[model samples]
Target: MDKFDKKILTALHENARISYAELARRVNLSAPAVADRVEKLEHAGVITGYHARINPAKIGYPIQGLIELTVKHQDYYIVMEQLGTMPEILECFSVTGTSGLLLKVAVHSMPDLQALIARLMQYGDTKTSIVIDVPVPLRMPEVVETE
Candidate 1:
């Protein structure tokens, strides 16, 4: 990838829905050139997927939390697969240390959280911490040095 490719990626990070013509204009490239670059990026897996940000409060799930789980043995993949199917579990990770998995969850209320935790009991021991505020939510990927 060259400087032009980097510029194109930066622009796409800001707005993935930008038209090919508009992207070409901003990047100072012809539409076909821009299209070719973007296609290459997509094929190479540099551009994985596109998504829209949604407000949890607007969706009736106002509460957000992180859950730390300690499972018996090393059955993280099985437990993670189950968590993935649950609507309340927004994100899940297989982590290092005593806590085998960490999960980001969103729910309607404390009662909902409690119910979710109860269900998770079948899998393993769990602890939860409610999020007070997200000072910095997830951001778009920025340019990074590659060896």
Candidate 2:
């Protein structure tokens, strides 16, 4: 990717719903050129997908929790696949520590959290911690300099 392509990606990452003309303006390119570059990016798998960021509290899911799980074996892919299918599981990661999987879950209430934990325990050993306050839940990616 060139400098223009990098600028386009940076703008798109901030707001995926931006119009091609607006994106072109930001990147100092013509709309057609921006469209072509975006299409190429998508086709090449550089732009995998676009998603809407949602507020957990606004949708009645006020509770957020992190779960650390230790499985019987190193079958992370299978476990991650299963966890991904669950709606409550917001994110899952494999870390080099005591736990095999770290999961971020959002729930409506304590009962919902209990149910989620119960269901997860069926697959492996689990430990959980409810988030009281979030100073920084998520952050936007900074502009990365490309060679």
Q: Model 1's lDDT to the true fold? A: 0.88
Clash-forming residue pairs, model 2 = none
Give the TM-scores of the predictions, in the order they appear.
Answer: 0.89, 0.84
Global Cα lDDT for candidate 2? 0.87
The numbered model that scores best in TM-score is 1
Alpha carbon deviation, residue 136, candidate 2 (Å): 3.7
The sequence of per-residue lDDT tens digits that candidate 2 reaches over residues 15-69 is 9999999999999999999999999989999889988889898998999999998
lDDT of each: 0.88, 0.87
Question: Which residue segments of model 2 deviate by more than 4 Å?
Answer: 74-78, 140-147
Worst 10 residues of 1 by lDDT: 138-147
Error of 2 at 65 (Å): 1.4
Candidate 2: residue 43 lDDT (0-100): 99
| lDDT by residue (tens digit), candidate 1, 29-139 | 999999999999899998898778788979999999999988877676787778879999998887899988898999999999999999898899899999989899766
